[model samples]
Target: MSKPSILSKLNSGVESSSPPMAHPLRQRVPSTAIAGLGRSLDDLAADSVATIDPALIDPSPFGDRLEYDEEATNLLLAAIEAEGQRLPLLVRPHPKIEGRYQLAYGHRRLQVLRILNRKAKAFIRNLTDAELILEQGAENGGREGLTWIERALFAKEMEGQGHPSKTIWTTIGVDKSGLSKMRAVVDTIPDHLIRSIGRAPGIGQPRWQELVDALAIDGAIKRAASILQSKEISSLTSDQKFVGLLRALCGQSSLAPHSGRREIRSSEGRSIARLSSTAKGDVLAIAKAESRFSAWLTEKLPEIYRQFLIEGATSTLDSERPATGAADSDGTMVVISQP
Candidate 1:
């Protein structure tokens, strides 16, 4: 289901009545914080409401959205101009900075207040880092302001900050497996590259996974870097940039493997294994034509691969003694090595 737009959230006056009217402007922080994933915007828990200087407050260390919508901001500016800042921003006394405050939520409101050169109405509390993030999540929750990659990036931030896996799961509202997939993408893609592509609100993990696979090919990251810096992508939108990068990369790195084949042979000129590639994937077939060796190969592949990874790809398993084991009672034992 599509998430409700910021405009829809703005029109929902089910919580509070109109306030007195205000003006516009913006900056966001880089943060990994999200808590109370189901909380509503107007329902933040606070001690009291008072007006404070927007300029004195800084955005939270964690961020939610990838990019702000200018049209949405204009709509927000018009609304506050008529309603007079009905909802109060959530803030706390800065833990480190003596004279300043840290904003928990209401980033857009704070921006507008800063532009109007007016003080912001806010609920001030002495909040810990965790608590501040939760308050911020409460404000952003149910708004669907975050895109798929944005959530992944936010999840990456949460893990980086030492938040336990369970905490991250609850905060981001994703399962353990979901978090794992997000980590894979963030781990494979460089941070600056993700920021360059922007939010990619229209793109999902599957398409992003394509880029991940393409990048895994040797020299693919360099190819991707070149594509990102090209003049063609420089003028594209965020989603457009992603499409262009993926298209360029697919043509360069991914296509090189298709319609390719590698056939191994023994010193005696006997066939060993035939490796063929297609759009679907690579297929490896052993010429032994014996079920026992195939079974042995299947059972030992993981162990062989694990050793290769642990020791480094430069080292081969050919030097090791051949694998040995008895087969099923009716079948013969087969010895096979990485050679």
Candidate 2:
């Protein structure tokens, strides 16, 4: 499918070639002309279109998007530079701050214009909190559209803003059942972790719910977060980051096929542990040469785990009694992370 611009359907009614300075401002096209009755993007009147200095405009208070794709954004920048900005952004006069405006949509266009050092063309409207969010949702939903998690996060944001469920459902283009599932996932997981995971557009609702269910286990949050904070986590793709955390939380082995052993190295590049994976489980063998370190690790296991339980409680879903980890017959210890 062709990518949609920020204006979406509104671009059809908007006049091309910004008129002269003395020209009359373009009047608000009727809602019916843009979207038919009862559409999410409809009803908000865009009273005028004007060219305003990009410096005077501010970001939207109710943001619906997480982040823009770099490739897509660069494409937009190139298009605007070559053809000039064809679509106008939507903004409202700042309610409290003087001589300032708050954006409703078209953030990408505005940012690109700022880079190009050009003024912005915009649809000016005074919108209520509900209307502002709805417009934000409609513009996004109508345009390139949000990923599953983005829609869920947007639903949570709307609810926090005091918008009714009907508005939330229609705006995000989800049914009641879908909205309930979204709320379930968003409410259970920490927003910080979800945001850390990024849009994960390839991830679907089933995988999200699986993450949620895993988070319900005792010490799961701290366990998952430790993995997330690990150096390897940052280098991983969004989906890989999520799957790793989920596996850690559920105490499940990696879903990937067994690929022999991978080395666990110390900061100085010495091999400290050898990790081998199987469908049934994984084993971390402390190097025989480092007997002192292995003994230290064994002695510290209980103390380290005590700390994990105490800390995990803070981020735990509910009050949970500390659970014990399974050990090999030789009694060597395996741990998620050391405190």
Candidate 3:
């Protein structure tokens, strides 16, 4: 036997129209057969899947994802075009507005279907805000995962919405320790900086922690901001941009201290040499002098030492001999007698 066609099977009973408005507080179970797979026939009657117009579904207001990868989305679109949507989306009846639905997960699929001008294959269920967030978190965490910073920001946003700590932890699939670390890293880096870096998938907790450490130094935030705003960084991919910012922050903290050396100048105040002193020795650097003069000094150094030795011997001889001289009319002096 051949496998059943998804389109024919799902479209059998449901008409392609806006889903009926549900009570604001009322929750409904899954109505689709695929959703009823693990449930009983009674449960299937209450909730079942349907194909609905794409225009009627609104994205989850509490959605955690801030950015989407365009290349990946395009690939998904191509795949769906060739082979119809294999997995169904999960959506709830819009809580406030009538005749619309809200998405729990499958945002990318919904977007592609909308762009293709086709109906969305979805499992319709009425869920509360907490249930919606839980499903969204689970789907993202288990599938194409959010980057580390993305998850951090999501957790931060959820907290800001008055969700308790335990709920946030369970929603993102992290424990207390992991959640604490995420919050710390997110709090240390400015939100604008994180957003500017974009979604850096594959980057993990350790590197982000290192970034937090670097930003703790005085003046580091200003330097990081300058790098992010640079033209060179503007053209890079999102992951490359994050790397560039990380390198800039790390470089700023690792600069070497300056040596205490002063320049010696000529009479005209032009620098001719440099003098530096250390515990080991004193150094006189004269590279600033003319090259010809330097070469001449190098060549005459031996001769100059020999002349100093000869002068020392003559001084000793003069000390040993007595003075005996005669003066001529031309003022020439000569030794007349020797003792």
Candidate 4:
């Protein structure tokens, strides 16, 4: 027997002579089943992974992360080299250029692929600017995550680009209060200072607020400039550099003497004490000493002063008293009367 055509089978609403498993009855299929099939095809299209040349993929114009750890990147590169890329990156078709794509996230992975001279496995989607930001923000938040200052700067950048606060909050996975605090840090801290500090990963809102308060003091900017210019600050890691700057600012006020007294140094030129001429008396301020000698000196000060006083009085008596020396029953005696 000849097989029936698919169109004729659909039109006649009849089962085909072919086995049930060989040909599905189109007429018997429900509208819901057809819809489900269409959805499955759409999903497959959306989820299909493709390997594309790294040169064709441009970084997201709205990328949030500013700093990447060298060691972490090296580790990632080693992993990809040994185990291959386990996850695919998300990217959108380049809006302005043909035959190009823009990354929404997975910048590190893309960089590794480029360095390896290999193609990037990515999920291509048509994304709007808002959608791009959302996807980028979500991926970053769910992953290793941006530092506090990084997030602050990102929020500020988004605001500068005219994105609303609600959108930014959603993207950053923060509430209104958290967004406000982040913005406050970005607003209060100077741009040069922030750039000098880099991304302080573990630093939080309170420490940032402390930094802002420190910056409000007079000469803070100059002090911060001096700190950034120092070799020690330059040698520190990003997080350590931030902490060094903060310590410099906070310590500036304490290091300056309130009494306007000059510090006194020991014979070795170490500042061991300070001297201030006050209306009531000459105030002698000793520098903080944590040594055993300091503890011994503190304990023996009273006895030493008492002995000094006794020696001074005896010397005065000897100098002023008349020479009246007589041999007593057992020894010589000198009786000196008070003048």
Q: Which candidate leads the pack in lDDT?
A: 2
TM-score of each model, paired residue for residue: 0.61, 0.63, 0.57, 0.58
Instruction: Write candidate 4's Cα lDDT for 181-234 as tens digits.
Output: 998888988888887777777788877887787778778878887888788788
Alpha-carbon runs more than 4 Å astray in model 4:
1-47, 252-339
Is 1 or 3 the stronger prediction by lDDT?
Answer: 3
Give model 1 RMSD, 1 decimal: 15.0
**128-235: candidate 2 lDDT, tens digit per residue:** 877787778877766756789998988888999898888788777778999999999999998888877888878889889878877776777777777788876756
Residue 180 lDDT in candidate 4: 96
Is candidate 2 or 3 superior in lDDT? Answer: 2
Query: Which pairs in model 4 have colliding backbones?
Result: none
Cα shift from native, residue 76, model 3 (Å): 2.2
> Candidate 2 vs candidate 4: which has greater lDDT?
2
For model 3, the superposed segments whose C-alpha errors exceed 4 Å read 1-46, 161-164, 252-339
Candidate 3 residue pairs in clash (backbone atoms < 3 Å):
30-47, 31-47, 31-48, 31-49, 32-48, 32-49
Model 1 TM: 0.61
lDDT of each candidate versus the true structure: 0.69, 0.73, 0.70, 0.70
Best by TM-score: 2
Itemize residue pairs with steric clashes in candidate 1: 20-84, 21-84, 31-61, 31-62, 31-63
Write candidate 3's Cα lDDT for 151-268 as tens digits: 8888887787678888777667678999999999988999888888888886788778867877888888888888888887867877777766775554421112212355655547
